[model samples]
Target chain A: MDELIINSELHQYKIMIGNRIRYDINTLLPKTYSTILVITDDKVAEKYLSEVMSNLQAENIFTSIIPAGEQSKSFALFEKLHTEALTYGLDRESLIIALGGGVVGDLAGFVAATYMRGIDYIQMPTTILAHDSSVGGKVAINHQLGKNLIGSFYPPKAVLYDIDTLSTLPRSQVRSGYAELIKEGLIADEELFQSILSSDLMSLSQDQLHNHIRSGIKIKAAIVEADEKEKGMRKYLNLGHTLGHALETTLGYGVLTHGEAIGIGLLFSMYVSESVYTIKLPYEPLYRWLLNNNYPLFLEQLHVNDLITLMKTDKKTLNHHIQMVLLKNVGEPVIKEISDEDMSSYLKQFLRKLVIA
Target chain B: MDELIINSELHQYKIMIGNRIRYDINTLLPKTYSTILVITDDKVAEKYLSEVMSNLQAENIFTSIIPAGEQSKSFALFEKLHTEALTYGLDRESLIIALGGGVVGDLAGFVAATYMRGIDYIQMPTTILAHDSSVGGKVAINHQLGKNLIGSFYPPKAVLYDIDTLSTLPRSQVRSGYAELIKEGLIADEELFQSILSSDLMSLSQDQLHNHIRSGIKIKAAIVEADEKEKGMRKYLNLGHTLGHALETTLGYGVLTHGEAIGIGLLFSMYVSESVYTIKLPYEPLYRWLLNNNYPLFLEQLHVNDLITLMKTDKKTLNHHIQMVLLKNVGEPVIKEISDEDMSSYLKQFLRKLVIA
Candidate 1:
């Protein structure tokens, strides 16, 4: 597989996709860095660390394994990683590699972001969900109040994705990861949406997976290039993330994977868009597909007030109002500040309607 | 009092050099920011925080006070500030004002730098030593292993230097702060050097104090403007800090004020410069002036090997060798990589020579 390149303001890097990429990660690293620290989770470390180290045989590499899951995205872990980096004698010339899913990527990337102010880092994602986080520079850890509440917009030097690792992921994980791919299609490409819609997405061929991820990355790369610091166009990437993050924060992180929450958020966004903006979207089809795929739409568990409260604290919120990205149709997204009455009314309507499908 | 401007790459901010800036800080901030969080030490908060908040009567402002001294510059404090910021309902539009000496400026500025990734911050430095740290936007918290081991290159939105606060400083502090003023002269301007050498530095007129600070800041601003991220010319500004930081880290922080450590480092640098680069400097006069001003030369307690070990871990040590800033003459600085043997030999000779002086 060829590399997909992202040209950001302060950094320019490539996303190299292939099967068993762990063996080639060493070659992708910058020549100046003699010291490499690979930060992964216990699960991923057991499965893939040695594979990555096999290629890094000639390098002075150090590996630190964090506990698996969202709980590891913490201040304590961030501090611990820095201590480990210091203990391993990692210097400014050294590099830190994130070698797991988004949780590991977010934790290790943030550690790299704050360690010695900032240091060079690479992302070698071993999960399907990491495709989105590994591309963008938005590295962060979860605060008690919210997910990604404390973080920096730090871009990675490279993103090495090994598709073979996806085989090890549960079916739910694979389906959840596909939500962002759907978002990229809905927000930017109508043809990509229609193409995926016509297919049996559950059993995607290697070529299908490649095209989906490449297109998703291309959409992400273009948006980030225009607004690397998330000033304007980059807000579109948070299409399903506002309510998605709110759910993640309120419901507890590990209860639902990122893509599952985002899956529900995406459906609700379409409903709200139709209600508020009179934007005609494929809300019925998308909602059906979401439920059929085992993504639990936990609308009954959440309240409008709690979601609204969480939405207010969002980094995207300006002047205490939620700036949501609503689509008129596939490939046509617009940002709007919704009133409280409209948000509350829409949530009531959506929850009332959810009894059937 | 007029605002002296610092033009950086992404941000250009003012250094409001005056006698009483605490009262008028609200007027200096951007009107768009509705939320303000002031990060200060207990000592400074007692003396200055109320006055600052009095002016910010219309804005929803918050204040957090930490214990005084270098210990406050820790990862624990950094994490606590973020938790406090989140608890205080501070959003992305919020501004954090650092109202203390270099400790507050570095610690609080780092909080703002990493909070929600990056946020706006103002530096209200309440000490003479803070003038140097406040200007460059090189904010950081100290690691247990080293001072400023964990930090970033995030610049503050403004530097509010209130010279009246220097009146609260002890004479030792005042003299210690003067070392950086001398360094600004040595690295960039000989005229500033000559002016300082011929004067009663302990009891300067207010106008003399203003001129010295302004000249020092001008020297700093120019260097930072040329190299905001410390890639090239900015290395010169660290004329004495390579050894200076090592001493502060190994000997324990706050044991010697930053200026006191830098003063001794400056003396040793000149000696090494003379030996290696044949740089003609007034080493005798500088040494006498240092001792005359109560700057302790702690030569007997420190060993050459320990200092060399600390220097090896310095951020400036490129490719496992010390990249020190040496001067050919006043205002002529160059970066050099000194060998371990060369470093040990120079330290032994420098320590031996200190016995006579």
Candidate 2:
């Protein structure tokens, strides 16, 4: 029973992380609610919906299953969830349980965020990648042009991350989750970073996964607490997300798992840091890890000009300037505004370095 | 220009009111927005879209128009607006200008509320009914089961109310807008109630209309400030709304204007107060006024049982208990839980009294 409390400006809630946390769903939930609508994707619903439902002690509990993937976070799918909630007569007092990975959490959290203006929702993250998303209140859907292009910063009432659910995740997904895990270590904790870099990426015990996820969440939670509305410190969490989102969007969403796309973005950011910020980040080892994991870091398939256009159009870029997060060192993250010309030059250099590494 | 500032937990900004105030849209809006997406309806677009667009000093401005009426607040329409917004490339730095009545405000506000998790939205109210809807941060879209069934509490960055727009509104709409206006007075201000009752319901000068709207907004603003989340005193603003929403929903939305339905509901709530709270409510003048204005207080078309059922299912009700807000007198409101049986009896008695009055 590894439970941590998240204190946010909107509301403070518990993030229960353990192997079998979903078993305590009855006690974890509020004693009273008009209805409960559990929103999950097809993949998660097929695997764990019945188990979640069977564990629920309350009445008027309904499940809405969206199709599996990033497409589920579309405006249409977001609308479908609202229709389901309306059908269930889920009122303000009703609870929305987002029971899946990042897609389910982001999509369902968004539905809860705007359904009747906002309602209470809990996150039951079933993927390691959701360890980052489950903690931060930032939830959104995607537009055809961009990933997470449409959404809100509505936080969940609590996050219940069960490591047991990770057992069924594909190796790519575990790697995807590691993107954020490593992000936490890179921007905030040197010891955590070195420990994570030394650990086995292909296989790890549940305890290691738990520790990594917890450390990532702690770093994220503190940053979120400092700037819940993303007014300041929250940008550090987007350490790799600037180009990460652009790469994800340019390649078309869901082509690369979020963490994988971000893994490359993280490398690009560190590469930029070495040049733009004059910070000596050991880029070779991290670049090799991504390469060994079969991450497509090669830019031959993706045009630099096209990717730069996507970066300029990124939601994070204000005033049409790309502000990419860079590392001053292992424990120091800085946001630097990179011009397209400079970004293209850096991309050429970074890819050249990636080939050498 | 009559400018007043609203201080709320979400955010605060000025509510600018006057005739042809949209002329100042350039200086009034924040200079930093990358783009502006003006969301209006067919009717408002036909009349004032260009004026708003031309008034914009910013180069990147776009407009989206839905059909005019409550129908535009549907899930489908809401999704369409998101699509339009996505098509427009509206980003986090962009602004959403809701330029119509409450439908546009609610629908567009709900869209902006969730668009990229919310960007700054400015309420450019073109209807009198919007005087109530515009001021409060309560924005929503309707479900088939209920009005405002899906929405959130995202306040606009500012409200720009042009009284000139109200001049073109149909008499029915002006009357519809009065429901919330009268509600504000009835719940909070004895003097305002007396003055409104003394004035010609159908005829008023533009200045007089502005004063009533401003006064109504002031009362609503005070309540909203006290209970932004509607946890306590803000429920007072729903004085006529409990049965009002039920009556509106039961009547088939759009059949009766929001005010006409709430007029009947207000009469019913007063009757309930007389019985349940033993409050001395001056019911005759208001009932006579309703008759004079052709507000359908006639219960011949409505079934008491159906209305009761609707009330029981109202979003305001909790745990199947229909708690109706009752007034002890003008400026003294109380929320009293009315059982199904009692509400039905009161409906029967209230109709009998309306017929006699």
B1-357 per-residue lDDT for model 1 (tens digits): 757787876678888888886677767775557788989999888887788888874457889999998889987899899989988878788889898999999999988988888899988887777878998889888877677877888888888888887777777677777889989999998988878776676777888888888889889888888898787988888888878888888778778888988998899889988988766798888887888777888555677888898887776766577899999888999999999999999988887887766
Pairs with steric clashes in candidate 2: A116-B151, A117-B151, A117-B152, A151-B116, A151-B117, A152-B117
Give candidate 1 misplaced runs (Cα > 4 Å). A19-21, A30-32, A57-59, A298-300, A340-342
**Model 2 regions more than 4 Å off:** A30-34, A277-280, A294-300, A344-357, B1-3, B30-34, B250-252, B277-280, B296-300, B303-309, B348-357
> DockQ, in order, for the candidates?
0.61, 0.57
Candidate 2 at B306: error in angstroms?
4.6
lDDT of 1 by residue, A1-357 (tens): 678778876678988988777677667765557788989999998888887887874347898999999999988888888889987888777888999999999989988887766889999887767888888888998878778888888899988888878777887787778888889989998777776666565777877877777788788888888888887888888888878888888888778888998987888889888887676789887877777777777555677799888887788876677889888778888898988778788777776777555
